[model samples]
Target: MSGYFVTEGSKCKGRPLTTLPVVINRDLSRIINNNLQLKSSHDLEHLRYIAQQRDEWTKLTARIQEAAEASQSEH
Candidate 1:
């Protein structure tokens, strides 16, 4: 769910940034897109790091089974 929201927000945010360079100058658009690509590559690496951390957490917590059982019992 958080991923979906972030992707939607990025789509909206990217539109104006991309449109601005295109409206101002053709060459500028290429430069802006290249920078965006580099930023996206970094973002991908960051997300992978986050996923690794999450997997570590799951290992530490026994795959969250305790929390799930507690929630089920509460209901």
Candidate 2:
């Protein structure tokens, strides 16, 4: 998925706002699922990595939600 940010604003009146293109890597679904499976299987070797993946997934989803809210507010 993708996101947008309003980077700059017009100093004068009747001018458009400047938007910056923000790209988000949203390809962690499979990885997250795999991590969940590993955890369910009681795999202790990669527990640290699995926890990290879960945290990253959480942050990514939160950012997605924030972006959606921002877009709605813009409209």
Candidate 3:
């Protein structure tokens, strides 16, 4: 468990810290694809989903930046 963290829950999950970038990339790609398929921004539901995705993207970007800074400082 040296390079892993266990999430607290009934079905405890563990994943390597290094895999975070891959997950973020996958999520961002999915969001971009969804947005690319949008024909119009008039639908309220679609607008809400887009807003949510934006927030997720922002958070992921921050996390990635933080990770990069941490890694840099470790040198």
Candidate 4:
């Protein structure tokens, strides 16, 4: 399968080469109707999500930089 990638034991197949997983809360309507005046709950959720993403990216970036430095030293 041209669109499949082997990972460990399972074979994951999918569309093209790019895809992003997204989760849309079903309670969105309820949240919106609750008059979440100052910094709505949804906004808070988005902020928390972005913070988590930033932390994850920072960790991955640090690991990559460390690996690159080590690899260069070995050469």
Each candidate structure's TM-score, on Cα atoms with residue i matched to residue i, is: 0.27, 0.32, 0.33, 0.32
Pick the winner on TM-score between candidates 1 and 3: 3
Model 1 Cα lDDT, one tens digit per residue, 1-75: 123224443244433555432332332223322222222445445434645897754553343455456557989
Mark the regions of model 3 whose C-alpha exceeds 4 Å error after superposition: 1-52
Colliding residue pairs in candidate 4: none
- The segments of candidate 4 whose C-alpha lies over 4 angstroms from its true place after superposition are 1-52
Error of 1 at 16 (Å): 28
lDDT-better candidate, 2 vs 3:
3
- lDDT by residue (3-63, candidate 2, tens digit) is 2222357455775544321112222222333322222213333434544798865765565
What candidate 1 gets wrong by more than 4 Å, as runs, is 1-3, 6-48, 53-57, 60-63
lDDT (tens digit, per residue) of candidate 4 on 1-75? 212222357545875344221111222222322322223455555535544898864754455466556667989
User: Candidate 4's C-alpha lDDT?
Assistant: 0.41
Can you list the residue pairs that collide in candidate 1?
Answer: none
Better candidate by TM-score, 3 or 4? 3
The 10-residue segment of model 4 with minimum total lDDT is 20-29
Best of the two (1, 2) by TM-score: 2
User: What stretches of model 2 exceed 4 Å from their correct place?
Assistant: 1-52
The true-versus-predicted C-alpha distance at residue 25 of model 2, in Å, is 8.2
Each candidate: what lDDT?
0.41, 0.41, 0.47, 0.41
TM-score of 4: 0.32
